[model samples]
Target: MAGDNVDGVSTRESLKSALKEIVDRTASVELSGYRDSAEMSGIPESSSKLAAQETSGISGQSDKELKPSPLSGTEMASTTATSSKSKSKSSTATTQQSITSRVETPSDADVRLSSAISGLQDYFRKPCFVHSRLDDAVDVSSVITAMSPDNFSHLSHSSLVRTATGVRELAKRIGQATIKVNLRSILIVTKARDNSLIRLTRELARWLILTRKVNVYVDAKLRLSKRFDADHLLDPSDHELDSCLRFWTPELTSMMPDLFDLVLTLGGDGTVLYTSWLFQHIVPPILAFSLGSLGFLTNFPFQDYEKTLNRVFDDGINVNLRMRFTCTIYKDGHQTETFEVINEIVIDRGPSPWISMLELYGNGHLLTVVQADGLILSTPTGSTAYSLSAGGSLVHPEIPAISVTPICPHTLSFRPMLLPDSMLLKVCVPRGARNTAWASFDGRHRVELRSNDYVTVTASQYPFPTVTASTMDYIESVSRTLKWNVREQQKPFSEDSDGSTTPVNDDEGADDDQLDDDWDIDDSAFFSSSSSSTALSGFNSAPQSAVTTGSSSPLHRDFLTLDGK
Candidate 1:
């Protein structure tokens, strides 16, 4: 109905264009008779079907061929021209809508990228988990090596500064590496005769057997011998353990340290001390749970055992090196006995009515004659223990130093002394004394020192590498466990003559000033040759090394005055 003669154009394109223009012209003119004829034009099948339904009501010319009509050429040309103008307007509207929609709406990827950019600064603003005060105050110079996570072979420098994701990455790396360390055993040492300890041990043992793939060991007597009250912990036979649990008795004591990778202590600080005693030579990492009364060394909490174990197995633990004392008793020039102590070696008058007289010598140099109730030769780790009770300075364990505190000295001038870790100290019960003195290691291994007997204290080659709990380090542990520096209440400020309120801080101010002056003095002079040097063994006379360890990180060194430098 609409195809006119076309000389050069494609038949499909020309026919469709002419049909579209004829349909528009006829529909607008209400020429209903010709509508059916236009619908039958040689257009595509889809367009022809749509036109047939839209013009169904039109009369005449149904299914007619698309040919030049009988109308005059002038009228046909004018109608086709009008239809082309309207067609162009409709096509332009459709194209504009398509372009506008594409530009206004964004893709999912684009939206996500925008969100990430907006939140990037906030992601970096969040602080990483750390003990700010402890990390700041720590003197890392004394630390021979800080046990942290892995280091890439070529990027060893960046490994020292832990990143935000360092812990997680390290845990993954350590777990992969430690997969081969099968039979990683743990030794549990608890306080004796306490129902709580028995219950804890039983629970821990059960957890170990059911959940972990490691071996558990306890004291043989705790599981074998018939104890007074706690029988439940021992009721389960060795067979029930599936060979995953073992025991260490008196006979096997020498090999306990070598067999285990870690020690779990379920008592107070005393439990830690006892555990340290068991491993006389080389102490394993101890995870000391704080159940005892005084828990200075027992930093871990019983409640956090599961989390602590997870970290331990993944090598996420901080191991602090604790210096130990190697004490040897020399009786009549013969080495009579030898032992190791995690804390101090005490020489006191046991059950004697008179004050004990002890001759102190450092590296074969006569130091002084001490007339006191007792003398405490403590390692830096022990400074917070027996030495602190005897008015000794709180020494940082990593400083590589030893403390000597006189207990109830006869004269007020007798003060505590702090010496380098390399120094060899000798405490002698002079040739003739009023009463025999007593010597003890870490408050255990009691021995009597007769006249002319001597006890030598030196830093042990074996150092105790204690596992630090996630909660605290040495400084925080001391503050929390020993309640050090904790005042009951603060006194109100007093008004000065200048109408300014001043804090009523005690003699701590003067002490701070003296400490600064002491940090400046050459401590090498203390070990120098001198004739009239008085023996000092008290907190006030503690060595400068104890107060301000010289070695530290570059940042801390800026604010800290170490070794008078």
Candidate 2:
């Protein structure tokens, strides 16, 4: 390895020397163009001839050194003709012709320059593509020259054209802006400690790296796991796997928000929730596989990962920005800890055998005194989760609303209420409260709220973007998992000749099938497209920083936006 490094250093040094020489020569040519153009503007024949002779000398030297000279044949001929014309006549026409020649053969000079660069590249046996990149970087002037003054903007070459009154016409032409990105790096969050999952991870990693040319990242634990890299799991000849595999820890994800293009979850909804946990600030678009049971969030089937991934990679995906709550716990009037809660935050009495007296305030105004067992503050995405079980409404994921459900209110009249996402609500354990309240963020991170300590809950700017199988995947999940509005099939009846109605006999297994088919139709009747239209356009995070205060950390700067525009 040391010898290899030494040889690499030598090659790089040689390449650098060659590049420096070319740069010096190009600089001399550019300088000659500017200085000679000014000098030959109105100078006599002898002066123009001197400039031409100097240019010819540079070209002649290039011809001897490199096969492809920087100056093309047309350039050389034009130089010679200009010199001859200058020697014969120092008239306005000759000067005009000389300037014209320079402009006319610029394209040829560029071609020759590229050809020369290519020839230089051939001399090196480097494995990387850096040599070819230097060709373009070194020839930046060529690009500026190509964009002539006449071409201000090329509408004909533009992707978006406003034909109709709306942007949909352009959307059809350009496709979804969210899906227009190059899906390069992917972080796969696999279910931990499962050999079968490990095998699937390896299989997916191989396909992503080899087939899609993507950088696959798994949890750091899988990098050297005995089961993950077991001999039986990998082929004996697959020595290249070690180098290709990549691992990402929680710390890295927190630091680098744009680390992954997309995150794939290989488990139930818990794994999907875990992904939300991984990136506290900015989260990439998540594509979850339903490997475990009760796949509310993980709708996509694991068996069809290839098809799903192909569609996501090639076409695009319909992403629903699930609303989240940014719960900030404040102790002694100073910010203690902040968490991005996907599901809900439970503020309940933990081990304390007393009623949890909590004060709820919205927008700095006292809303109510939660004289209950506890309060469940949840986003619309968590409505079907713990919030629903607590008698909260099953709000859709796209709804910009928060569910405030009392776990078990002291008063029977106290019911679950839906609040606008814009409301900045604060739940505080009163200093004179009976017992201290415990807070659980998304079913994890159990924290205690003491007297005078308050927790602020608001609609998070950073939302969890989950890829859906369809635009109505959330509805389908509700119907399938929660069995929403599901009931026994009504028997079909027909009027007889005697005016008596009788039940129509049908196959035993057919009623369930008919009812299943009817549910989709019934659902379409209730929920219209406008009702569930995405409030935010799509995922836009890690690009710009969010609203930051004095206490905000650098890692938590990016405020995830889903502006449809």
Candidate 3:
């Protein structure tokens, strides 16, 4: 046993010495190769020094025992030289085996190489992929070249150039107008299981204080119980509460007016909606930070808080103006109450009544009498919300349009319709209507509507502000967010390709089974291209059409213009 122990110690020492020599030789070879390559490529010699420094830092305490395995030393050295020769080839394909082997080996060299590869991957993947059309290219020579031109009118340019210049000018104006006015207070409202957001909020508050941008006011529920004193000991709970209140709410007379210029919400879309509803009348522009699960509205990433805030303060990024709808409920033909809706306004039967019978009218013309569970009146901004779920078209935000979608109507012919924004919409329950209906705004704030009540809705004067990084068009946002027809590779049958056309399939002749059965009848009755003679009856005929034209169909024209206000 004594002899065996002595032999093991000697072998270990010999291996250690061999590894030290191999490491020294490898380092010398790598340094020389790196220098030669840098000189050949005309790269600065200082870069080699920096790389060496970084490599040394990564090699750390292993410097003393920096050695290669005895069995693999010769093979590894030969492979390393071959790899250097093939460095101009595809790095990924050539380096895979080496990377896997190194990862398996327990050494600082392996860890350093893995870290460098990861850093390279991160650098290559930093920018997002954007798709643009050929006609959308803008000449940004003045901006890119750092030339201070007074106006874009002086330059000869195309329509794309003109649009880019307009955006630049608008950004400049926003920058000039938006000053970092000292905020009187700030409120960070959140719900349960949000410790991560709570910590991030505290850090953001500290950042704001350090920059002297805004005076923050946190909710009383989140205040720390104790304070640190001169001796590094905590003060009494009463003293801490007093100090916190002094900063949060100074005056005792009334709750401090929401003098905050921005309400930075840190939660899901539900949280944003709640905050908007809480201060709907007095709320300022919101900069929502996404910390919850689904973030359709709260888009600002929590990790990039600093960059986002800087852009808001300095660059004046684009803010998407979202429109809201205001609905007034009238009981017995008099305006009784009003509600604001950011998403949509719904008129439906609640738990107390049976299904509803709603009579919808546009500009005093009876469009349809619906027997359904509910009806949704929404602006283009709200089209993507409940309206989409109820089978309405997804209208662009900039388009001046409104959607009327019925929810589970009894008649299959009742389909969603888009109307011009200028039209006034009314939903009323007739005196002999079956059930009582309730009107709600954004799924909250309900008001009971009796058989003799009506709800009228229209576009409101107020618009919500949403901040974005770029001035991409509305269609671009939809395409990216909704993943609509985004192809990973170009197809040969694309419009730009000059390929032979393929033969049509026999299956293409089949009728579309997805169409509703009642749609054909409805189309023939309401939207026939040819004009036909018809009597003008007011909601009395079973199959009479409501649409009319003048001079050609006298009876239809008279019925359409009967009740002119």
TM-score of each: 0.53, 0.58, 0.49
| Top-scoring candidate (TM-score) | 2
User: How would you encode candidate 1's per-residue C-alpha lDDT over 93-176 as one tens digit per residue?
Assistant: 665554455455553322332343223223212221121112233443333243433324444456545543665564344222
Where model 3 places Cα greater than 4 Å from the true spot, the runs are 1-187, 191-193, 224-258, 352-354, 363-365, 473-482, 486-565
lDDT of 3 by residue, 16-126 (tens): 222232223233433221121334323334433433444555345343233323223344444554656576575666566665564456454443434443432332232
Please identify which of the two predictions, 1 or 3, would achieve the higher TM-score against the true structure.
1
Task: Determine which window of 10 residues in candidate 2 has minimal summed lDDT.
Answer: 1-10
Scored against the true structure, residue 492 in model 2 reaches a CA lDDT of 87
* True-vs-predicted CA distance for residue 342, candidate 3, Å: 0.7
Show how many residue pairs clash in every candidate, following the order shown: 9, 1, 1
Order of all candidates by lDDT, from best down to worst? 2, 1, 3
Report the Cα lDDT for residue 139, model 1. 41
* lDDT score, candidate 3: 0.55
lDDT of each: 0.62, 0.66, 0.55
Q: Please give the ranking of all candidate structures by TM-score, highest first, separated by commas.
A: 2, 1, 3
Clashing pairs in 3: 19-67
